[model samples]
Target: MGRMSDEPARWTRATVYPDMWVDPADDPRDGASPDGELATLLDFLSGYRMTLRMKCEGLDAEQLARRSVPPSTMSLLGLLRHLAEAERDWFNWISDDDPLPKLYGERDGDFDGAVGEQAAVDAAYADLEREQAATDAALAEHPDLGERLRKDGIAVRELMVHRIEEYARHCGHADLLRECIDGRVGQ
Candidate 1:
């Protein structure tokens, strides 16, 4: 009474309908070449960034900044700003340069200040892109993931893995938030 060897893996993403945000063929992240660890990690990171943007797509400033979840100031706009701040922090940690002052002055300024304003929304997107690019540039300097960064010698691989984890967790939160906002689901 053993399972069939030819059967697919236990974990599958099968769905009744094409409920995903994008069609399989249209998914930019599909068919990503497994070039290497660095390449794979970077690709996944980029895909997650794209996913976050997609989740926020077609939404107005108010929608983007709405704290849909009660008792939690967690909004899509706040996540975007917080991500930018987090991305900037990692870049500083990797370089040990501490180049820019923190994005938001207060401890939770990133989220707390995510007001429902078009200007804030635009700035968040811009900041996220700018910080991501800066981090990518700094990351290119170290090809060896095993290499330790200057600040406290945190390995490059650890940092990359952490970035992926952070994005994935937030993306899950986003799925819920977006569903609550407009009933749209699937990634």
Candidate 2:
């Protein structure tokens, strides 16, 4: 018989990747050996990005847009939208001071737009791609990872680290949300 509880245990041993990390001890931020702190940060961000992608793979638009949890506006699609905005907000706005307007519109709930629809899913992914490319370009132009950016008079490196932290947290959310949606989870 199925449990009567609404709160389901979403994760299982079979669903999670057992050996995803190459070497936990080997820090990605090891100094001066070609791959510097910036490279390490980028690599870490890319890893989470790929993880998010894998978590959503094979899911249809409706599934991707499902909220999975009650009282939260955090669908996989919403996360994609949020991340794209975050990338642009930090790299394009704070770092480069780009004047480009925000994507996905200006409504407070714009990220939640077209929820459970194929068009929304496609738009979220496309926004992510565009924002990611812009972030890479901005990073490429900067080159000096050590150079500090003063955003609203705050240090830019601090903001960048915060951005990385934000993605890592959201990826964790995606892990659980994806598992809840379809019992598929890993990496």
Per-residue lDDT of candidate 1, residues 33-125 (tens digit): 788999999888988888898889888989898886568889999999999999999898977655778997888898889898899999999
lDDT tens per residue, model 2, 139-160: 6766665566555553545656
Positional deviation of residue 147's Cα in model 1 after best superposition, in angstroms? 0.3
Q: Which candidate is the best by lDDT?
A: 1
Could you estimate the TM-score for every candidate?
0.87, 0.76
The best candidate by TM-score is 1
State, as a TM-score between 0 and 1, how close model 1 is to the true structure: 0.87
lDDT of candidate 1 vs native?
0.84
What are the Cα lDDT values of the candidates? Answer: 0.84, 0.70
Regions more than 4 Å wrong, model 2: 1-34, 95-98, 150-156
